[model samples]
Target: MRHTVTMSPDSLWGLPQIRAVCLMAFAGISSFAVMLAALPVWGVGHAVPAHLAGTITTVMLAATVLTQVVSPALMRRFSLRGLLVWGLVLLGLPAPLYLWATALPGLYAVSAVRGVGFGLLTVTAALAIQVAAPPGRQGEAIGLFGLAGAIPTMIGAAIGAGLTLSGNFGWVCVIAATPLLGLAAARGVTADGTAPGGAGESLPMRIALRRLVVPVVLLFAATAAGGAVITVVPLELTGSARAALVLLVFGAVTAYARWRIGRFTDRRGHRLVPQTLTVIGAAGMAVAGWGFAAASVPLLLAGAIGTGIAYGALQSVTLDLAFSRVPAGQAPIASATWNAFFDAGTATGAAVFAAVAAGSAGGAGSMLVGTGLFLLVGLATVRSALAPWLERRRGPGRMEP
Candidate 1:
């Protein structure tokens, strides 16, 4: 059996493929961040029913899932650069539609189009990172890829929210511009000489199911915490500025944590990262819960920072673990499957938390309970699942490279 060799850190960083991966991350994540920021504004400007706002987000997520199912096949047919550029174009062209969207159906259609574009961007970017990364460094590579969005998400959300506060939809156009920039970045990425592998083999539904269950459950719990924040927190708070500040702080802290953890995972391993993060996350949730209960602004901000860090690292770690178990050729599918869990978690979290908040469990009570769940069952299970994998990576005969 011929083993593939891993690249040294220096070589990995020098590769154009790696640079491409970072660019795609920046572009893809920024686009989504802008959309998230603009959605609430569009909802209010158009008199969108409050109850239906969640549904709009659901539409985009649903479309993303549907498109992701076929993304691997699409990559097989097109070069990464081709897929990325087209995806960016698709993502960019749809924002103007928001200006004319007068009804729920139109808004949902816009979201669906953007979602499809996002789906394409995500899968291609995942594949790009896999091809670019050194063996044994997949965790770090993916973590860095995640930072692309994390940074832009923090910046774009702040800008979008600021523009929305001005009661202007023109900022949506500005947000769309980032995707075009991404298109230019995508063009610079040379297609790796390697062709797509595992062209015709379908991912067994049973196996994908078995592999995904635990990770999905944990991710769902965490995202539910996010959903509660995105949905219930804004509505419950008296001012949009304060609410936006909360979200901004959350994004910033999360991005920083992800960067640190990615570098840590590259050197240390995935297990320790998650274990440490989970403990910290648990404490953060406790603080957040306390803050919510007491309505303390300082405590709330601190909690948001902690939760953001944990959440950002969680997704990247999960993706690294999934890829570690799968063949290199199957990394894209593994990533897509992993992301599906994330999307499901987001949806489930939003739905469950919304119910709690609506039920007279005030927003504070709902957040406390939801975040508390993350600290307890969610973080605990994630740490437990990662233990065996960590042990294997450390064993004498099972060196990471």
Candidate 2:
């Protein structure tokens, strides 16, 4: 007989396991928020050159990618609760260090320390959620889990921007404290050793690579578009207020779309929803770029919303696709690998788009290039290149169990 796991709404609140997952999610995500909040402030405060800001971001993302590779092994050795709490402390306590970071060396040190913490927190939280979630509802649980990070990305950027406007270094410290809130939440929850059952068993790297290709490619495309906008939009607008508004709109739409897409994927499958969103996103980027070139505020806003929606949908859907194909025990590794792709895409997008926009043709030319890439990704999905391969590997008629 198959086991049936039912989780009540109130049960989620009362159960230590469920509560633990929520806490970790909140803590991990808040750490991410602090990082986003810190970047621009650090860039301006130290009078770092604009060309260097992208490199700084790349260093942090590179750290994340490296750490994510080893996260599964780390989780296997340490309890989830232990890893999360320690990671939170490492993430939170580094704020004071940032206050002292007046030089590039100091900033680099801070990035390395914080990057490790963020990387561990991300992987641990996802593992906790997957283990805590009752079977058959993993998709919804992961979706909700994702919001801890998504919501903050929107809020943190705005708050970070606001704090910067105050012309105070103290606000950066305050923002750094934000991750502690998650630590408090994590303290109330318990760790489960059984969460990652059978995870340490060796698997072929080739198999893992083949399974991850589709989601990684999709991630690359989405982040490239997002990266292009993030790099070029501000320069094109030439007004802090307008640039901030664009980011704010992008964050809000992305957050809502993430929540809705989670449920949609849980009911449907990952393949179709994301493919459709990619096409829409390409169009949105095209419109937004055109608007940026024409200086049309309304068109820019429309494009921002579309891009946000598409990003939100794609983020969760890609994770779902990975988890659906792998063993339940491998969720953490799967989640980490997926995030590494996201970070890589973001890093590449920032660097490449900035270079492209620096040319005589400017931001408009860069957007056009980004739009073409997104559309190509969309076409690949429509051709069923990834879906059929994944379906065949798992065999027919096997849905998430």
Candidate 3:
């Protein structure tokens, strides 16, 4: 059998396909980050109910999931650039809608439209690099791709959301829309969704999904906590200015950890990575909840820093492990599955916490609940990661756990 050689993480940057993926991922993620920070404020400011406000994200992310499930077929039908252009259009054109979208249904409509665009951009951009990378280097290549996209989001989320805290939704939308417009104008990327090895004779989606469950669920839990923070922490923190900083800390730490920990995963293999991430996540959640309950900004900031690191590491490591579990030619399936778990987890977390926030202790109770969930999930993932290692120690002939 012929084998494809892997590119070292540093060497991988030289490839056009990977570069294009990074460029697009940066544009897409930055756009989403700004809007994500701004829109919930917009909804609540205009007197939309908190529960209804949360549903906006739910609809948007749900739309993302719906689009991603069918995205592989869409990629085959259109040029990757063509699809990306549309995704950018969908992402950008609706910016001004937020200005006029006062009614609940109108806001949800705009969010849903934007969500489809995000779904397309994310699915295509992420898988593009996965297909582009050579063998063995898949984990590093994806990690770097994630790192490149995250830096802009870290900076932009703080600045954009900080401005939005003062009711500057219009400019945030403008900022969100501008980059994609420039990219589309440049027309630098013009390619279709062609895969290496032809990705020949695709496996049925149902079977592929079944193979992806374990990694996907762990991802779901981690993202659930992250989604909780993104959705609630901003609204619940002492004030929007300070609250915005919490988001800043979250994004900054997340970006740094993804960059640093990813290379470690590539070099060391995935052995303890997932379990370690869960532990870090649980600790962060515990501290964050403690801060929330006590109304301590310092502890809150520290918690955000810790959770941010875990969130970043969780994202890169989980996806890296997901790819490891799949067949070489099934990059699209892996991308779709990874994306779904993330979006779905985010939507679920947001809605769940939003429901709880309307209660007596405000969002502090929600934070405590989130801490418990993280601890349980961390323990569960550690056990899952060790099960196979324990089995190996017992010998290959052993089947029972």
Candidate 4:
């Protein structure tokens, strides 16, 4: 027997558990978003080498990935509320430390510590959703969850970038402290002592990894592209409000697409959507690359909008797919694995794009253009290679599940 949550959208939104998780997610993600653009820009301003500054993100996300990998074990050893509380503490307490750690190595150290906290938040937050949501409503629940995360990105990235550029670092620290407010909501989360999927019915980690390659690849590619944009554009377009605007539009569009696509996928299914989004994202990267290389604000804004839609939609879809492919009890495994890919891809993009900008004459814009071409070619190759195998597996005319 399985549990089913059959409720209207309003009713679902009204659930105490849902409200608690959303508030917590909003606070945690806001802390992350505020620092995402600000830290790199701050590093560049304080005598850090341009190329090395991007590594701030790389270091943070590297820690995030490592923490996510070990989160399953952590969840088993601790209370969910305890972990969530500590994650918020670690994430918030370190922001003010940035004021003292002006050196590159010190900054990286702070980022790495913060990343650990973020890692705990990412997996635990998703697990909270898994436990709170009713059967058959996972997509909508994820959409709402995504919506909470997106608003902060939209508001925080632009604000952080803009503020840091204006030389207002203390304010950035203040905004980064927002995660502390989530402590109240964390207590209300419906956490039991057991890890999700601890029962014998769950699949082994190795098998789950094998079953999840498709969504993981799609998620990795999309996040890599988006992360490159977020990491490099601030450095490339310094001293101009245009950079902030570009980030603003990207965040706004991403929020709407991620939230809406959840319901759409629930009704229409997931078959063609991921491929279509990849195409759109690849194209957006190309346009934005041209915009960056050319320093055209309009083109940058246009590119941001296109990529934002694809990035947000792919996030929701990949997550929903990850949940759907696993045993119901195995949600924590899926959440941790998916989040690890998410941060790993972002870190890879930040490092690779920053290196490309440093090495290439055409800089960030050129890197974006090349990345777009790479994604396009990769997608086409993957489809060509997979179609034959799929046809043989499911018969010539069957739709993919």
Q: Local distance difference test, per candidate? A: 0.67, 0.69, 0.74, 0.80
Better of 1 and 4 by lDDT: 4
User: Which scores better on lDDT, 1 or 3?
Assistant: 3
Q: Per-candidate TM vs. native?
A: 0.85, 0.86, 0.90, 0.92
Model 2, 226: alpha-carbon shift in Å? 2.9
lDDT of 2 by residue, 1-401 (tens): 01244434543345566566666666556555544534644564578764455555566677877888888788777788888787777778786677778677777788788777777777777767777666666667767776756787676655555555455557756767666777667655565562364645645667766677777788788877776666566545655577667777877887788766766665555556667888878888888878878888888888888888887778777776777666666666687788788878877766677667667767777777878888888777665545454776788833321
Better of 2 and 3 by TM-score: 3
> Candidate 3: which pairs clash?
none
| lDDT over C-alpha atoms for residue 384 of model 1 | 60
Total clashing pairs for each candidate: 1, 0, 0, 0
Candidate maximizing lDDT: 4
Candidates ranked, most accurate by TM-score first: 4, 3, 2, 1
Lowest lDDT sum, 10 consecutive residues, model 2, at 1-10
Give the better candidate number (1 or 2) by TM-score.
Answer: 2
Clashing pairs in 2: none
Off by over 4 Å in 3: 1-11, 182-190, 195-207, 397-401
As a whole number from 0 to 100, the lDDT of residue 395 in candidate 3 is 77
Query: RMSDs, each prediction?
Result: 4.1, 3.8, 3.3, 3.2
Q: Any idea what lDDT model 4 has? A: 0.80
After superposing candidate 2 on the true structure, give the runs of residues whose Cα lies further than 4 Å from its correct spot.
1-18, 34-38, 41-45, 194-203, 231-236, 358-361, 385-401
